[model samples]
Target: MTATRLASVVLVLLTLCSTAVPDVARAETWEAVISATSPDGLGTATVHYQHLAAGDSPTAEEINDHIDAEANRAVTQAMWDGSTRRPWTFDASGRLTTWAITVSEVFTGVYNTAEPHMPMNRLGSVVCDTRSGIIISWDNLFSDKTAGLTRLGEQLETQVAAVASPTELRTWRRSGQFAPVDVNFKYWIPTREGVALQIPEVQFGRGLKVVIVPWSAISDLIAPEFLPITG
Candidate 1:
């Protein structure tokens, strides 16, 4: 073959080789389960959490570490803490506070996809402590907790107002619920799109209202621990 033709072929091969190779930054994640359980008023309180190891984005491990720590804490507290003092099934008065005590990890997207080195895979957990139940707010997941909460609260007002009916909005305002300035937003879950704020069942006699807040809306306020919550 002519030198010129051979040179062109070699260049094309090099380009193909480079394109086929995956970036080093993207780590392969092998899924692992970490669980802990403790006795509860009913049967038992269990925390079965998922951990992403050897996956993309060096920060995956750091985020999983946070998940593990928080999960373990919830189980431990439910087991030893005053959780049983007021049981969900029945309290000292023999009145049922709740049906059961169950805690589960609600991973974002409702599943764990740690591979491919994506941004922060935010985690939210719900520990059914019975009486009032246990919630791991988005604020608790970060360091600048107050600031994060403030932003989350403020954003929720707009989101909530857009969907609330006139009657519902009035009820919220008159009932001192969803305060505009104080955003006492509590109880959140990770959704496929963003963080979902669960309006307590006690508030409106139902939990049909869920204020879905995107991470971009409060990214600036999040702490370094769980910052850059982008996928």
Candidate 2:
């Protein structure tokens, strides 16, 4: 072949090779489980968390590290801090659009037990974007924060009242947890069925109450990009 034709063919092959390779900057996650004990033999930390399985983007790496660190932090607080709490479950789910992480810890020891009669369980979670790794804020999830929060609050109250006793409902309403505010609804995780809103023991006189607000209920209120949140 002529030198010019040969060079052209070589350039074409190189372009195809590059195009066939996966993008290193694409963010992907892998879940890892570890059962570890503190060095001082005080307690144990068995946590399930996410890691940057495939991605080189700075944002993705940072978010992955943050997620890992947060999970480790929760376990560490229980172990080294003399809390004697055991993580019953540390579960997480991810899709092409979103990632959700949740941890449920049970208090076994007497330390920091305010209400001995009440349940000794705590729930926590973190949700973020899959690509940019930016933590999904309340503002990002809802298009109109005020209206969205009001709707969420209404749904939460309706769901809780359905199962809770009249007295329990009175206590829940007095607690002001279901108010249209971001701080009130902290423990929430995205699920395939809907967004699972958690009402911990502290907020409700009863034990933990999880209410799944179906996507259909607030489909229009949700941001367009976050529509059909898989998990």
Candidate 3:
């Protein structure tokens, strides 16, 4: 072995096979499922979600009994609930960068004794990045109080991220006609669970609206401890 010691033992066995390979076996994780199709599409329901940690916080009877058993098998009482939370950190190669989700909805309670219709509080926050689960940033806050009219809401919030893969666009304003609004979405990756967004068609000015959202339609009504950490 003398060609300069066999080229330094083949460069130390190629640096020990690139430091023993295995970065979580080339990482790409997903695990969560729930798919439902309706709005006059006959019927369909598939549920399988079990990934809740990151300081657990999913209650409201597990998102109102899975939205009252998928809205009473689509008969539709229209009751729903929400919650989801997880992912605080993991990036040094560990991946799974961020996640924070909060969703709430309480409908079917409307009274107008001249104008007293309330109840519909929504709060949603989503941040995802684990080698392309998509969703870079999203924030939504909606509150309503009647009897005199008081509705404060917020959404979209000028998001910017998503350089490629499927597609994701964001822009917002809309409150009281701030005007600007653009949210284009299309991203799907869930054989296991996490990342399935398709707006189909959503425009503001020209007014084309056809929205279809899955990923368990926002994680089976939220509150699965904010389920996030897909790396």
Candidate 4:
């Protein structure tokens, strides 16, 4: 072959090689295990959890370990306390994307009662990066933590106000749970529709409440890498 023709062939080979390479971002593969603890008088605690089933990456191993530990904790907690039969329930569901996995947990009835003589509900979540196997915090989803959280607080107020009565709104604002603080906003996970934010208490008699920050509202606030875009 002439020099120019040989160069052209090499270019084509390189292009093919590049395209054939797998995307490192989606390297991890996992399976969700829907399980429950052995039933006792207390009742069964259930979970939909993810385990790294096919990947050999170190990050996958770490993520698997976290899943096991979390599942164990949930199962143990759900076991009968041997006395209290409040007909309460503890359950978890897992959501997955190529880059992240989130486990959203809920507790209902007596077990999830509010603090300080108040009656509220419980909400929790665990979000982990599939690539690095890192358990990410609510703040970690944002490119600018302060700005994102501020906007999140604003969204919370807007959504909650729409549904809350004047009295309920006043009480929630007093409790500080409606604030933008990290601890107050622990129960959140990204879903296909939007990012789900859970409110532990907004009213005395009312149970837990959830509000979604739509992708349209937060597409710029969250880091693109952590978007949890479903297939």
TM-score of each model, in listed order: 0.43, 0.62, 0.20, 0.60
Q: Model 4, stretches more than 4 Å misplaced? A: 1-50, 75-122, 201-205, 224-231
Among these predictions, the greatest lDDT belongs to: 2
Q: For residues 1-231, write the lDDT of model 1, one tens digit per residue.
A: 334322221100001111221322222223333332224323133333343332343444444454455554443333443233333211110001111221223432111122332221222344222112233345445467666666676676676677768888777767766553323454555544566675544454333356788867766665554443333
> For candidate 2, what is the TM-score?
0.62
By TM-score, is 2 or 3 better?
2
Off by over 4 Å in 3: 1-30, 35-41, 46-50, 53-200, 205-231
Residue 1 lDDT (model 2):
29
For residue 204, what is the lDDT in candidate 4? 35
Name the best candidate (by TM-score): 2
Could you tell me the lDDT of residue 14 within candidate 4? 9
Candidate 4 residue-wise lDDT at 177: 49
Ranking by lDDT: 2, 4, 1, 3
Candidate 1 achieves a global lDDT of 0.41
Per-residue lDDT of model 3, residues 1-231, tens digit only: 224322221100001122221222222222233333333333322332222121122332243333333223222211111111211110010111222332211111111112222222111112333232233332211111121011111121111122212233333232222122223332222223443322221232322222223344344333333344221
lDDT of each: 0.41, 0.55, 0.24, 0.54
Model 3 Cα shift for residue 142 (angstroms): 12
lDDT per residue (tens digit) for residues 1-231 in model 2: 234322221100011111222332333445555444444344444554445443446655656555655554455444444333432222222222233332112111122323345325545566656556566657888999888888888888898788779998888788787889887777677666777786666676546767888877887898877774633
Model 2 ranges off by over 4 Å: 1-46, 55-60, 76-119, 228-231
Which runs of model 1 end up more than 4 angstroms from their true locations? 1-42, 54-60, 80-151, 162-167, 174-176, 180-183, 186-205, 214-231
Candidate 4 lDDT over 90-193, as tens digits, reads 55544434323543323232333122443334344556665577777755778898777777877887887887699887887898745667865766666666
